[model samples]
Each structure stands twice: as C-alpha cells, then as structure tokens.
Target chain A: MFDINKRPEVIQLSHGGGGKEMNKLIKSLFFSAFNNPILNNDEDAARLHLNGDIAFTTDSFTVSPLFFAGGDIGKLAIAGTVNDLAMMGAKPEYLSCSFIIEEGFEVGKLKKVVDSMVNEMDKSGAKIVCGDTKVVPKGCADGLLINTSGIGRIQFDGVSVTNIKLGDVIIVSRDIGRHGAAILMERESLALETTLTSDCATLWPTVKHLIEAKLEIHAMRDATRGGVSAVLNEWAMGSNVGITVKESAIPVCDEVKGMCELYGFEPFDLANEGTFLIALPEDEAIKALDIMHEFGCEATAAIIGRVSEDRPGKVILKTPWGSRRYLDLPQGELLPRIC
Target chain B: MFDINKRPEVIQLSHGGGGKEMNKLIKSLFFSAFNNPILNNDEDAARLHLNGDIAFTTDSFTVSPLFFAGGDIGKLAIAGTVNDLAMMGAKPEYLSCSFIIEEGFEVGKLKKVVDSMVNEMDKSGAKIVCGDTKVVPKGCADGLLINTSGIGRIQFDGVSVTNIKLGDVIIVSRDIGRHGAAILMERESLALETTLTSDCATLWPTVKHLIEAKLEIHAMRDATRGGVSAVLNEWAMGSNVGITVKESAIPVCDEVKGMCELYGFEPFDLANEGTFLIALPEDEAIKALDIMHEFGCEATAAIIGRVSEDRPGKVILKTPWGSRRYLDLPQGELLPRIC
Candidate 1:
C-alpha cells in the first residue's frame, strides 16, 4: 500500500545528502528505471572492461527553468551524454555526474531532477559511478547545472567518419526538433496548443542494433544543438563530400512543425535530443532502416539523402516543390540551452 | 617592445581560443610566473610516465564574481583540484580542463582568468592534457564555469584517513581561513582595513617532500568548503576517536583574525582554499613540519591538537582559560562556492 506512483514531484537537498531519502529516491526511481547489472550493483564506481577500444564523451547541462514541459534538466543531462557516446558506436557503460547548485534553490526540486536523471540513466542501462557536488550562494548561479561525462567501449572496429563514401545513404532516426520546440513553448507566453512531447530517449539500443546488423555504417552524428542541418554540414565538411536530401523525405511531426511555424523557426535548423543522422552504403540502407524500426523508433526513419561526388563539402536540399536549395551551416546557436 | 608587466588585468575569451593573444598571454604571464619543464612543452595534452601508484582529483569553478578580492575563479579551480590530489599523498601530474561559457561575456576578462589558471598549473607542475568548450546562451548562466579534473600518482603507502590513530598529533599547513575572509570581505563590503590575500596555492610539492622523507603521515585533508572545524569533526567521527586542540597554538594572520572578529565569524569555522591538516605520529611531527617548510610553504607550521580515545566521535578546543568546549561539525555551508 505504498502508493509509490504518488511520490512528490519536487526535489530536496536531503536527496543529495546520502541519507535515507537519497536511498529511497535511488531505489524507487533510478534503479527501477535503469535496471542493469552494473547499476544494480550499487557501487561507488563501476568496474569496466578495459580491453576494447574506448570512446569518451562529456557534456554539461545548464538548461534554464531546470524542469521544462515534457522533461527536466536531469533527464536531458543523462540522455545527452549517452547519445554522445552512442554516436561513436560505443556501448556506454559508466558515467560521472557533477552538480553545481545554487543556495536557496529548493532542495526538493533538486531531488526531483536527480530522480529524473536516475530514471533516464537506468533506462539507458548506463551506470552512474562517482559524483561531486558544490553549492554556491543564492543569486550567484542559475538554479542548477549538471555536468556528465561518459566512457563506453567502442565495439565496432572500423567505424570512423573517414569511412563515408560518395554514394552512402543518409537515414534519420526520428522526427526533428521536438525537444527544442517543447522548451521554447514552455519559456514563452505563446498560447499554442499541441501534443509536442520532447524526443528525449536513449538511442543506445538502436545504435547497438545498427552495429550488430553488420550494416556498412559510414558515419553517425546526433542532432543536438544547432540540429540536423548543423550535424549534416559538419559531416559533409569533415568527410570532404557533398550531400543532397529530399526535403519531403525528412520526417517532422505535425505538432512540432506547427509550433515551429508559429514561432518563425525552421525545423531543419532546430535542436533534436534523440535523433541521429546515419550514413551507410546504399546496399545496406533498407536493412538498417528495418533494424532501427524494430527498436520502436519507426515513424520517422527514412532515407532522406545521399552523399554526392559532384560537389564537395556542400549540402543541398531538393524541396517539395521541385526546386533545389543549398542548406547552409547554422551561423549561431538557434535555441540556446536546448539540450 | 611590449610592456608585459603593465598589461591589463581583466581576462578575455581570446586567451582560451588558441590564438595570438593566447600565446602572448601564456608566455608573458604564465611562463614567467611558474617556470617548469612539463608545462613549458605546450602540447595539447601532457604525456607522462605512471611509475608507482596514482591518485586523481577534479574540481569546478563557478564563483559569482570571476575576480574576487584576493583571487579569481581560475586560480581557485587549479589550486582546489591540485590540493585534492596532494591530500592523498599523490604527486600531481596531468590535468584536463573543460569550460562552460556563457555567450556575450566580455572576451578580455576571460583571458586574464585563463592566464591565471595556466600560471597556477605551471606552478603546480601539472600539465594540461585534454580540454573541452561549450557555449550557453547569455543569461542562461553566469559568465563562465571551469571544470578541471586531474590524475596524480600516490608516492607513498599507508597514507589515508583509515590509518589515523588515537594518540596522533595534528599539524596544520598554515593560517586557517584567510581565503574565506577575503571572499566574504569582497561580498559583504566589511569596512575592515586589512591587506589579506587568499592562501590558495599548489600543495603537491610540499606533500611530496613529506612522503619522500618517510615521515609517518597517518592522515591528511584539505580544509576547503566546510572549513577546518568541519574537516576535523568529520575525521574524528570517521575514525571513531576524539580530538583536542589548543586555540593558542593555531596560526591566524593578524589581518584575517581582525576581519573575522569584525564580521562575528570564527576563523576555525571559515574555509581555507590552500591550507591542509595532517595527522602524524607524535615522534615524526618535527620532521614532517621541516619537510613542508623546505618546500616554500608557510614555515610557521604548528602542532595544534592530538587525537584521543576518550569521548569518541567528538572534538574539543582548549581555550586560553583552560576550559574545553565542544567543536561541533558545521551543520550547513559557511562560505558556499569558496573554491
């Protein structure tokens, strides 16, 4: 008769104080959400296998409002770090979290955020090992900032951006910019009604599936800050190849598209927390799409474009109206603190 | 010829951008301040040998005002991380820095702060290994936050709090809480005319000398955020032992004492960025003090207290009138974000 689902939504200081409340929060939320062997062990640090090649990624979250419409800073922090590791075709195993908190910020709010982070990490099957906390005076900082660094084993041997070729097909994981749109909607006073939930979920399993399928994955990049346009532009520049995409093939949820239109924002340049741009050989594109779809990320998986040999280091979009336009790299951060 | 000594004091972002101004700042200020072989190499990451044992430490700086009365956030970040490794009797080696910058911050101010950090690392003989930079939107964060994590090798065996004993003598590195006083003075605008500088510096060399001299250093701790009183209380409680200290034997600079008196604060309860406490066997106390002094540390190191068996898990301070009073652990943060 615990009525566990009726738990408090706010965070508290004691949740981080390594006391009874901390234990309860970890057990009820984190362990339940991210039940894995390494995390379930409940050790200060996870013992990782050191034999394979390693991929390391670190990201810091300074999301305003701490908690947003669909997700909070805690979930974003874990998801962002895990996705960074996943983008490298690595199986994320361990993570280190550090918190910089402002004084007078509700302790209960922090607990809620931390609990959300734990749940996200559990869902992703990544263990939180080792953490440090520092408190600053009130008004000295925004409510809270979380820094997370993850280390994972690079299971694939020949995965590199250099492997990208002229005719490789580009496949997107899901709809774009849901996370950014949700955050913007929460921040502004626009009376927009839509079911635009944040696309904040772990992509490790999908990444693992693609790797296991023996698909010739040439390159992969997460559409985080600056969105798919930024990531595709970087890939084109890095690989010294040109890319062309069919604008109609790109998936955009109706709710997100409507929100972007209302806000005078382009979905292509907005941020996406859970989407990834994958480059693979044309022969393997269909099979890879099938594998990703099997992981319940089906609606938005599509062969949006292909690498080209004619023009180098440029991205072109074939518009829905039969006109070709060059997709330029993002000039500056579109939605700052989107991640 | 450039008058390097007359250069402006404010920091600039270009200093961290790996450009001409950054090089000049490094050579003029950092290289001139701390001349060391490893630091002068100027590689992207420092490469070193891991001979015997190792210890690691990391700390982040997000102080409200980048530049404080006595020291800036940059100096504090370097010293804080270095001291954590030193407290474990480890020889500090390589350090990694990551910056979370807020957009629209003045570039010149960031340069001065980075120059200070590089100088501190050079003085500490720790090399900059890896670094990362992420920019957040203006107003989403305070000016800048720096996260520095480092790896150090433990030079000696049996150097930990677990080795502490009932009758061991306690020795302090120097004055207790000048750093905290300077920060408070900057914030609260106390009209105390005192030239108090923060005691923030690298302590690895001093610790190394003690370990090399084969002094019986049972335990060591850097009295930082929670202050000397908090650290001592934790040590006593952790070891299930009692501690007794004579107030007269402790070192406190006249300026800091005056400031503390004016502010109605106890020097014992305030934080110290550079000071450390060592629990040593009574017989080896002098040799340990001698080694610390030879390393250019405060030469006025004193034996302030002794560990005791009676009244376990409690700390007492002996007053000038021969009365003993309980020194309870600090229940809350005294000076948040001191480091």
Candidate 2:
C-alpha cells in the first residue's frame, strides 16, 4: 500500500549516485515493493539457504514500448526468468533484479512496473531476494531496462534439449505469436479494431501441473524471441533428431494471423512470452494437453508435431497444402527489443 | 586462446535477435570466452549443485568509458558482484552475466571486454554459469551495459553491517579514490602525466586470506560508488554506534590527492572498486593487518577509524588541526556511472 505517487516525479542522477538519494530510493521504492527478510537485511548480498541441484538463468529485458498490450518490462522480466527455471523442471525460488533507468524517467511508471513484477512473482512463488539499481544520465539509455537472474531447485531430472527422442511428440501450450503481434501493433501504432493482447504471462502454473502429473517431459522451452521455429530448430539439432511440425496444427490467433500476413511474416517466426513447446512421449501428450486445459490454458494447447529419426538435425514443416519445407532457424532480425 | 579477432566487425541487430546470427555470435564470442561444463549444456537454465547457506548479489556496470586505466566494464561487472559476495564472507563460485549492447558497437571491443571479465573471474574462482544478451537499437543505449549476478557459498559466518560494536577498530584494505579519480580523468580528458590507475581488482584473495587467518571480522564492505565516507556512515547508522575517524590516517594516492585538490573534492567521498573496510576487535587489528600485507595487499592498508559509544548513529572526523566534524553520508551526486 505504498503510495509511489508521493515520491519524486522523475528519477535524478543523484538517485543512482550511491549516496543519500540512492539509499532513499532503494529503501522507499524497491524495499517497499519487494518486502522480505533477506532483502531487508541491507547487506551487500542476500543470504539464501539453498540445497540440492539448482537452476540458474539470467535475462535482460530491453523490450521497447515499455508498456505493451498485456504486460510491461517489469512483468516480462519476472516471468521471463521464472519460465526459464520452470522449463528446467525447477521450482522458481529466488531472483536477483537489476535495473538501468534513464534519468528523467517518471517514478510512477517505475512503481507500476514494480507492481507488475510483484504480481507475476506471485504466480511462481518466487522472491526477489537481491536487487541493484542504477540511473544513467538522460539519453545514455532508453527509458528502462531490467535484468533478472533466478535460482531454482530442480525437482524433476533429465529434462533437457538433448533428451528429446524420436518418439516424442511436441505440444504447444497456447496460441502463438500474440506477444509479437501485440508489440508490433503497439510499436506501429496500429489502430486495428481487435482485442489482441500479448501473451505475456508466467508459465510456472501449467509447468507445475505437468510436473505434478508425473508426465515424462523430455524438453520444454518458451517461444520468446524467435518463437516456435527457433525452439524446434534448436531441439532438432541438440537431440540429433528430426522434428516434423504440422503447420496447420500450430495455433495462431486470428489477430496474430492477420498481422503476420499483413507484415509478410510467418507465425512460427513470431515471438511468444507465455506460450511454450513441450516435447514428451506420444502417450503423455494427451495427458499433458488435458492438464494444460484444466489449468485454464485458453483451450489452445494442442499436439503440434512429432519427433522422427529421418532428417536428423532438421525441422520439417508439413504445410496445410500437403507440401513440406525445411523450418530453418530464423536468419535475420525479426524485431529488435522484442523481449 | 580464442581468436576473437576473427569475429564480425560490429554487432548488428541480428546478433541479438535470438536467431542464427545471435547463435553464431554467442558460440563464437561468449562460449569461447566463458567455456565451462555447466554453461555448455545449452539449456534454458544452467544446472548447478549448490548446498548450505549461499550469498547472492547483483550489480549493473554503467561506467561511462567502456575501458579505464586499469580495467574495463567487463572486469568491473565481475569484480563488483564478486566483491559483494566476498564482503559477505562467501567463496565466490558462480555468476550470471547479462549484456545490453547498442547496435553498431564494435565486436572487437566487446571481445576485449569479455577477455577482461575472464581475467577478473580468475581471481575469485567463479564461473559464468548462465547469461543473457540483448541488443538495443542505436541511440537507445550507450555502447554497453553489463549486469552480473553472483552466487557463492558462505565460508565465513556472522559478517553483517549490524555486527559493528563499540570496541571494534576499522581497517581499510588499500588506498581509496583511485577508481573515481581515474574515471574523472578519463571523462574529462585530463592530460595529467601520472600513473593513477583504478583500484579495480577482485578482493576474494585478500578476503580469503583474512578468513583463513581466523580473524573475527564483524563487518566488511567495499567502498564502491559512495566511497569510504558512505560506508562508514552506513555502518554507524546500521549498528547504532558512533564512528571516530582520523582523516590523516586514510590512504590517498598523490595523484588522487592532486585531482581532489584541483576539483575541490573530498578524497573520502570518491569511489573505490577493490578497496574494502573491515571491522574487528581492536586487539586483533595488527594480526589482520599482517595477513593483509602478507597477501600482497599494498602497504597503504591501515587502521583509519574506530567505533565508539558517544555520538551514536553518527560519524565524527578528527581533522589534523585539533578540530572535530561530522561526516554525513554523501549528499549529492559525486560522480555518475561510476561502476
């Protein structure tokens, strides 16, 4: 219930000078949002009690248009790193957040971003245990950039890209390309009459359910920047197996489909934040889909493809026209700062 | 041993697009520089074996000049986070690095920065277990910003800012203000013909020696952005004790002194990267000093101050002219983008 509006209107250089202003900002803003014992210690580092196999990951969110359709950089920062741990079959536990804010940025927007981060952390039960803030002079940086590093305890073993096998089937957690399309619309200032939103959400709930169901998942990856095409290509190469993806089975919402067609882009190449691809045995595909559905995954979760022995180290796309083509790794920059 | 000279000339948007070009840049540049078993897995997150109490910390390096007199941003990124863990009496083990690069940045310069990071990590025996890279459009960001979040096992316990007691003496590891002075000179293009280098180093070796020597250190901290004055003031307020400092006892290099005089700056208010402050029993000061000296700490290490019961929650400076003054936390921005 901290009234962030009452603080300074804009961040000052002194706020990051590591002096009284910096300390005041840290305590009043960051400490208020991420209230916890470990963070409140005010020590140079957070003392954490961690055990067993742990997963560590880091991401820097420079997504432009900080405020997008469904989320902002703060929410993406938390969900992005948490999803990485969740994909590794780890329970998201602790995270370290660092922000590089441009001076003159509004403090209210920062508070909103922090609020969104807090909301997202609630989904995975992750805690922001340690954080650092730096404010650069105006023009030295964009409005804001967030870097989050997470540590999680591995609960399930043997989940990796190299573990994908020929008999495994690929499952899409939800509709694809919403994140990219949404950002595209926001950035382009498209006035299309559509209720399209970015699929920026935490995947830990669905991932947890899959884990709790005892499904033998071989590999899991969120379609972030390069979308499904990049994930499929990496899996095929890493496992030394062929991945036959049914292009028609891939779920792309109507708005995203229209956006891709208009922009001469492929849906498979568009990014997604919440949607993910799961590789598992064919027998577990149905159960995985069921669990995903039970968790309100928007009824878009479906079996999108299957792994095979032929064409090792390649991903083959079976088009709706009954033709096939190589789904190569994305070649050029589809979108800069797309998350 | 990697031939970094063979890489692309400049980083393009495709290098951070999460596609083929991005993959190539990562494999050729990052993978080669930070080769480790855990990082080579190519998983969404790095799998690590961690146990017991661990220290976690994060820092973002936005130093104005990418390269400085004695080090660069990469070195500061590693040493800064590693020093935080070391200050908490932890054995630096794993680190996560994330980079935000501006498009059109020279790849050769990036390679040199990476090399500096590798060299700095060697001092702490820390591995880059996981990392992320993002490229922002030109004009969105400066050349580069590196965020390093570190994890370490707590080797020594009970090192807290609140542990400072009235009977403890304060010791500084080496001469201060060189880092701030070096950056100031670089930014202002000063033509001072002096060998004033930044004290940018990894402090794990010195801290490790102190712990091994069985010194009952109560509190330890690196004088970073806010400098020695900030550390002392924070210590006093955190522990609810008074601190009396002999201003003449502080170690300041002649070059730094000259710069301070010319710039009308206080040496104690300037920053230091490698220098640190330690509080221990007054009787054990000599033993701690001996260990520091034997471990190659420069002869500048000295007892600069002590804790006191009078003037609680304040810092008193004993000037050379038989006068006393209160040294409050630095009020304004001394220097921005200073580590």
Candidate topping DockQ: 2
**What is candidate 2's lDDT per residue for B92-167, written digit by digit as tens?**
9999989999999999999999999999999889999898999999999999999999999999997999999888
- The models' CA-based lDDT, in order, is 0.72, 0.93
Report i-RMS for every model.
6.5, 0.7
What TM-score does candidate 1 get on C-alpha atoms?
Answer: 0.82
TM-score of each: 0.82, 0.98
Deviation in angstroms for B250 in model 2? 0.6
Per-model B-chain TM-score: 0.84, 0.97
Model 2: per-residue lDDT, tens digit, A154-217?
9898789899988999999999999999999999999999999999999888888888899999
Q: What share of the true interface contacts does each candidate keep?
A: 0.08, 0.91
User: In model 1, what is chain B's TM-score?
Assistant: 0.84
lDDT of 1 by residue, A216-267 (tens): 7888877876678877776777688999999999999898788878878778
Candidate 1 residue B156 Cα shift, in angstroms, is 5.2
Worst 10 residues of 2 chain B by lDDT: B1-10
